[model samples]
Target: MNRIALAVCALALIVAACAGSREEVVEEFLPSLESTTTTAANGDLPSTTTTRPAEDQQIDELIAGLADQVREIRGLPLALPPLEFVPGDQLEERYQALNGLKSIGSTRINEAYLQALGVLPEGDSAADLVSFCSLPGFFDPESATLVLREGLADLTPYGRRLLFDELAGAATNEAHDWWGTMASLERSGNTEAAVGLWALVQGDAAFHAEQYVAESLDSTDQFAIRLEEIACQQESTSPP
Candidate 1:
C-alpha cells in the first residue's frame, strides 16, 4: 500500500480503539474511506489519497502546534523536518530498512566489543537492543525527517503526548547536534561517554515533554497520559 493508505489505516486503527475486536475495527475503518492512486513524478512509490483532504491538513496543523509547544518548553529554536507516518505493524520493517544502510561489519564489531565490555548483554546485538529499548517514534537526523508510529489519528491524549515526545526530541537534536556527537563518540570508541551523552539527550527531551504535559494539558488529561505511558512502559518490558 502507498504511504497515504498506510496513514489512513493507522488513523483508522486509532479511532477504532473505542470499537470492539480487531476484525470489526478494520472493517469499520476501511469501508468509509475513498481512495485514488497516481504515480509519482520520480517513478518511485505511487502516491494515493485514501481519506478526506482535511485529514492530512489536520495532521499538519497538529504537528505544527506540538512543535511550537516543544520549542516553548525547551527554549530551543527548531527547524522541524518533514513528517512521515508508518503503520505500527510496519515499524520493524521500516527500522530494518533504515538500519540496513549502515556499515554492517562495523556495527557487528561494535556490538561484540560492547558486549565484551558488559555494556550490552551476551546475546543482544546493538540493533536489537536499540529496537527494543528506544521509543517507537524517532527523528532520523540523516534524513532530516520525523517518523512516527501511525495510530495518531484522533489526537487522543496519549497520542498527543507521544507526538510531543518526538517533537521534543527533534528540538533537542536541533539544539545539540545530537546524532553527530553520538556518531563521533562511537567512531572514537568512547563507549562510556557515548552512553552518558545519550542518557542526557533523552533526559532533556523527556523533561521537556513532561513540562509540556504539566503546563498545557488539563489535570485529567495529564493523569491519563501519565497512566498510559506507564502502562506502555510496563507492557514493553514484560515477559511474553
Candidate 2:
C-alpha cells in the first residue's frame, strides 16, 4: 500500500498503540522530561481541554485533527490507500487479514485520545502512552503494554511537553529525534499513526489558525527540511 493508506491504518491501530519490532534509545535528554505535569499545574501550557463534550464524536474529530496536522508536515494530501475498499468477493478475506488488530473499543480510543491529547482527569503520578503521546493512568493493561512497547514512557519529559502541551520549543535536532521515533511506528505496512505523531512533534505555534503545514511546506520546502534536519539530523525523513 502507499504511505497515505499506511498512515490511516496506523492512526486506527494507534488507538490500541502498537509500533514496530525495532528498539531505539532516545538520543538526548531534556531535563524535566520525567515529571508528569498537568495543564492545571502550569498555567503557561496550552489548555488540552476543549469546551466540547468528551464524547466519541468530539474526540474522533480531535484525533482526526491531530492526524491531519502530521499529513500536512509530510506534504501528504488527505486520501486513504486504494486497498482499503476491497472487492466484495475479497471482503471476508480482508476482514480476517485485519483480525490481528487488538480489540480496543471506540470509547476506549476516545478516552485515551482525550487523556493523551487533552490532559484530562489528572491525578495519577505515573503516565502511560496511548499513542505517540502519553497519558497518566493504569486504566488499561493494553495501554500500559503500548507505553512500554512503543517506548512512549521512555521518551524525554520534554517529549510529553511537546506531544501534549501544544507549544513547547524543541530544537531542530530534538524534533527529528521525535520524527525518527514516530517513523518507527509503522508495521504491517501501516503508517497512519506516525503521520499524526509528526504533527505533535511540530509545535502548534508554528501554524496560524486555519493554516496547515503542507501549505507552508509547499511555499518553502527548505524551511520544513531544515526543521526536520535540526530536529533529527537525517536527510529526507518524511512522515508517512
Candidate 3:
C-alpha cells in the first residue's frame, strides 16, 4: 500500500480502538438504575418526613435503579418487532403482571422473565425468538445463564447484581458486543454468525433461540460443520 493509504488505515484502527460503542459499553458495565435524592431547602428549613424506616427507603431506591434499567430496554433497537405490535407505554405489560412489581415481590421476578423469554413466539412471529437474546446478565452466552429484561421492576440492586455476576466474563467484552453488533447481523440475515455466538453459551438450552436453531438448521454441510466445530472446541476446552 502507498504511504498515505497506510497512514489512513493506521488512523482508522486507532480511532476504532479509542471509541466505545453502546453495545460495548453495555457488555462491559452492569448499569445501576440511578438513584434520586432530596435535600433540605436551606440548612435551617424543615422537611416533611414519612413513617417508613431509613432502610426501607434505601431498599426502595435500589429497586428503582433496576427498574430504570428495564425501562431503558424499550429505547433500544429491537432484534425484531415484538411477537405482536405493542403500544410503547404498555410494553412492560407483556412480561409483568398489573400493579407493577407490588404483586410479584422479590422472589418470583427472575423466574417470570425466564419463563417469558423461554417460550417461542408462535407461528408467524417465530423469528422474534432472538429479540431477548442479548440481555446483559440474564443471557450469558458463555455459561448459558438464565433470565430476561422484563419483570425487573421488582428486583433490587442486589438481585440485579446477582444476575450480572452470572454472565460469562468472556461473552461481555469488546469482541462480543453481541446485542448491538450481533443483533444487527441477524437483522441483515447473517444467521450463521449471529446464532453461532450462542455456541459460547454452555448449557444445551437457549430459551427461545433453540426454536430458531432447530427450525432453521437442516442436515446441510455448512450448518453441520459449524455446529461440529462448536462441539469440538467445547470438548477440547473442558477441564480435567
**Where is model 2 more than 4 Å wrong at Cα?**
1-176, 204-240
For candidate 1, the lDDT comes to 0.52
The local lDDT score (0 to 100) that residue 210 gets in candidate 3 is: 29
For each candidate, the alpha-carbon lDDT, in order, equals: 0.52, 0.28, 0.29
Better TM-score candidate (1, 2): 1
Please provide TM-scores, in order, for all candidate models, with all chains considered together.
0.60, 0.18, 0.23
Clashes of 3: 2
Candidate 1 C-alpha lDDT tens digits along 48-136: 22333544566666667777776666666666667666776566555544433134433212445445445457876544433222244
- Residue-wise lDDT of candidate 3 within 1-240, one digit each (tens)? 011222232233223223334234323322311121211121111111223333333333433333333223211211110112233233333323321122332211222322333432223222122221122223323223232343232332223332322222222321235445445644665433333332222111121122323443354633653454455445444675
Predicted structure 1, TM vs. truth = 0.60
TM-score of 2: 0.18
Angstrom error of the Cα, residue 162, model 3: value is: 7.5
TM-score winner between candidates 1 and 3? 1
Q: Where is the poorest 10-residue window by lDDT in model 3?
A: 74-83
Give the better candidate number (1 or 2) by lDDT.
1
Whose lDDT is higher: candidate 1's or candidate 3's?
A: 1
